[model samples]
Target: MPGWEDRARIGWGPGAAPTTTVQVEACPAASAPAAWSVYTGGTWVASPACVPLVIRSEGQQVEVRLAIGAACGENN
Candidate 1:
């Protein structure tokens, strides 16, 4: 299991275009699996990837769903 709280950081680098650069960081654990993707027209797609989920579109908006599972030990 994770700690008392989970954290997420969103930022863009200096000297970079705002829309062109985005950063996401999760605390305790750096990344999680991207559970799904949502686009316009109420469309939903299954997208699975390790996080710091990055979008490269200039002005397109998207909804990303993420699932962070608890950290399990040898106890099962």
Candidate 2:
């Protein structure tokens, strides 16, 4: 393994933010709970808020679990 050097530049271009896929589940009314909320950090808030959910940095990959119920008068 002499004179074997790994040389390469790896990164995104300008205006390119790191992309990652998030897993979200839209439960059916039958399977949805009567009323549920999500446990964010230390406090629990109303699930399925219109605002975007923020995730904490851990490593290259992470998994988040959120329990959301059905909307008012909506099935699934």
Candidate 3:
């Protein structure tokens, strides 16, 4: 199974643009996935399975959300 690093916090707000770099471990297990995505503004952005995401501008401060599940068409 692939292991993921701890989540890194990045402050975001007006005039505050931060970019973070994350490393994704490689795993070749049936239960291990290799890709994920981040959601913002009702849209999904493809991202590394184990990487810190960059946030620019805190819009509405709604909340930072992440969804970890099977890829497009992989049965759980």
Candidate 4:
């Protein structure tokens, strides 16, 4: 599937622009006991990566996939 990931990725919250930086946690809420991510480590992003997040409440959980990547910008 060429665009399978594109179709699978889940996103929400304020629209964000990507940047290659080894800083910023992927999802802060996921770190809490209420939520978690299937993909672990690499809190900071320097390249394209995929993260599957699970949020739980009242014995139920919703799964979402996050796609993080580099944003194009000036070469300089």
Best candidate (score: TM-score): 4
Summarize candidate 3's per-residue lDDT along 1-76 as a digit string, tens digits. 1122233223233433332332323345668776554322221234423232333443532323334331432222
Worst 10 residues of 2 by lDDT: 1-10
Better of 2 and 3 by TM-score: 2
TM-score of 3: 0.17
TM-score for each candidate, following the candidate numbering: 0.22, 0.19, 0.17, 0.30
Per-residue C-alpha lDDT of model 4 across residues 1-76, encoded as one tens digit per residue: 1334342333333443332221233566545776654432333343465544456656786855555663333331
lDDT of 3: 0.33
- Residues 1-76, candidate 2: write the lDDT tens digits: 1111122111233433323323334434776767764422222233442222334443444433333332432221
* Residue 62 lDDT in candidate 2: 43
Best model number under lDDT: 4
Best to worst by lDDT, what's the order? 4, 1, 3, 2
Pairs with steric clashes in candidate 1: none
Pairs of residues clashing in candidate 4: none
- How accurate locally is residue 73 in candidate 1, as Cα lDDT from 0 to 100? 38
Clash pairs detected, candidate 3? none
Candidates 1 and 2 compared by TM-score, better number: 1
